[model samples]
Target: MTSSPSQRLAWPDVAKGISILGVVLLHITLTVPESKDTWLAAFNVWLDPLRLPLFFLVSGFFAQKVFRFSFAELFTRRLWYFLVPYVVWMLVEQQTKRVEYHWVFGDPVFDFSQMTASLLVGHSMAWFLHSLILFNLFLWCVRKLPGWAALALSFSPILFIAWQAQFTSIAKAIMFLPVFVAAACFRDAISAFASAIEAPFKGEWDYRSFWAYSGMVGAYAIGFFIRRTWDSYAGAVEVTWLLPGTEALVRDDVHILVRMVEQFFEVPVGIAVAVAVSYIPVLSTGLRFIGSHTLPIYLGHPIGLTVLYGYPMALNPREVSLAGQWPLENTWFWLSMCFVYCAIASLVLWALGKVPVVGWTLKPPPIGASRRTTEPPSAGLSLSQKLTETRNATTRK
Candidate 1:
């Protein structure tokens, strides 16, 4: 079947696929029992740049497609699909040793009251989903304003900096929404840009291929930098002299400035890289598959981490560690195992989602939904019919 205009715009799918995989890597690197080791820390440090922002960018892009929905619809969609899963998973994590554990083993002491609090505040990996829900809500409320107004409101951190002389702490998580919205608003301009860049070169030197490769690497680099610097910034800020007395009162403003800079510069860079990767043929195919299966992968991997591998590893980390050590002298061995394990878990979940009765819950928009609305004229139609159609087309086209 011929692809529609929407199908041709498969770059987002590619980006999402690659994005989730990288996200998986981030999670694995963080959760690998020996993540505290210097080498692994360094690896995680480098992966910082694109992690959160990439997801935000994709969220903005997809959300834009449905921005016409009523407030209730938006909330329902996000609540049922994203928020519910987040809360459920948070509870699951609380009951298990996933977030808390024995002090000697890096586990925190567990209390039911504290665990309940953690649900509201979010804990461990759950925070990302919590933040995502908040970000979407904020955008949905402000989305009706003029583009510039919405953008300015969304970029309130920057404005807050000029107004209050300090950054806000919550600015970072939500700052990228504006960038995502901006990209969505200026999609035509951006596509023209990609086209222009592609026009000058031939073959591998062509604009599309080069930018795609460069963008992907650049996106990864941005993620790495964010991971590295944000961690350092956080650590430094936590104990900084800037937060005493009145400074404590003014801390939110200060954080706003920091987040504005981080998102304005870093988030767009990541989005650009993702967009570029989407255009590359092979990368696009792989990314689309991954992107298409994002929900399954996201929902299922935790089960693997929680039940299949996590407990087993916790019981005998040394043995699992040895199995994880097959690639001698390489730290990546641990990371690779985590990746493989998560993938397996995702695949299992994906399979379950395809069961005849239950498959309806998670399937994405069907491919048939992408078909064009206008139909071509029949070959057997009278010449007068064709002439009449041509006259109408001449008027409308």
Candidate 2:
């Protein structure tokens, strides 16, 4: 069933909400000169190991039904939702990227072939939308495989990634597929696990109560170590061997494997944090709201960001630290700035969504909504209707 405002899963939405926010902060620190040297940037980068992996895991859980649909239904109902927004936004992103390229480099831009390649796989911010489509198709195609074999096979993409991290959106999609497929194939077990976690709160205490507390603590420790590892590796430090008694696989040239491994391990960490937050009433409410609106924010923020930061980056001016000597001072400042940037992007989307033709580009009529002419157009779909039209997606919220 598609989620409603009242019926939504708290942790997953909270996780998505947090992940998208991190994505925006990462964009902000990356582009805004003042934030370049701050702790916020470092934190976001450190989170690289888990953010997308956790996101894909949650998405896969919602997208489990993708395998049940016929091919035409998959394309029309499922893939179409993501592809439309991704392609539509890419036009906006590319035009901005091209202008910024010229400003910075004193040249037009990249080759047509390069642009086309990114178009196919995705580049820039809308890449996650590309993932929503590709992962659905991938799981559907491999639906016949035993769940264990399918998960094992999902790692096969790593063969290409080990030698060459893909230059486009494909890199992330490939890297995170294992987690996505696992979530999709093992939804029942995961749901049972979540139920177990929620058991303590529900007053049905047992072994699950022990697991809920201990597992979360374990996740935090593992998450910290993995984040530090990623930080080191991303900074050009060579990793110690992952495989015990074997140096055959670890190499400077193949650090992508380390990154991918860290990403996989980080999933539990993200889920644990998300669940922890779910218990906090205020934070969970806010995050779940943000999670419900993932599409517009995910697709919209980059356009404003492209315009805002594109030229500045193209100019390539020296950036200094906004880092404060006081504890968490830079963190607070960066957090505020990230909110402002997101607020502006959301404001722009809100304004544009009111415009006649342009608004539809931001939000297409949710599939099959137009068919019910008797009901007022703005009345919105019933949760059941939305589930049918948006099976590939979750709640339109």
* Candidate of highest TM-score: 2
* TM-score of candidate 2 on Cα atoms, chains taken together: 0.77
lDDT tens digits, residue span 71-182, model 1: 6666554544666556765665566653325522775656777777767755545566676676677667776677777776776544333334222224444456566666
Task: Pull out the clashing pairs in model 2.
Answer: 104-314, 292-397
Q: Would you estimate the TM-scores of all the predictions?
A: 0.66, 0.77
The CA lDDT at 235 in model 1 is 36
**lDDT (Cα, tens digit) per residue for candidate 2, span 211-263:** 75677567657756765665565444444445433334345335565566667
Error (Å) of candidate 2 at residue 279 is 2.6
For candidate 2, give the lDDT: 0.70
lDDT of each: 0.58, 0.70
In terms of lDDT, the best-performing candidate is 2
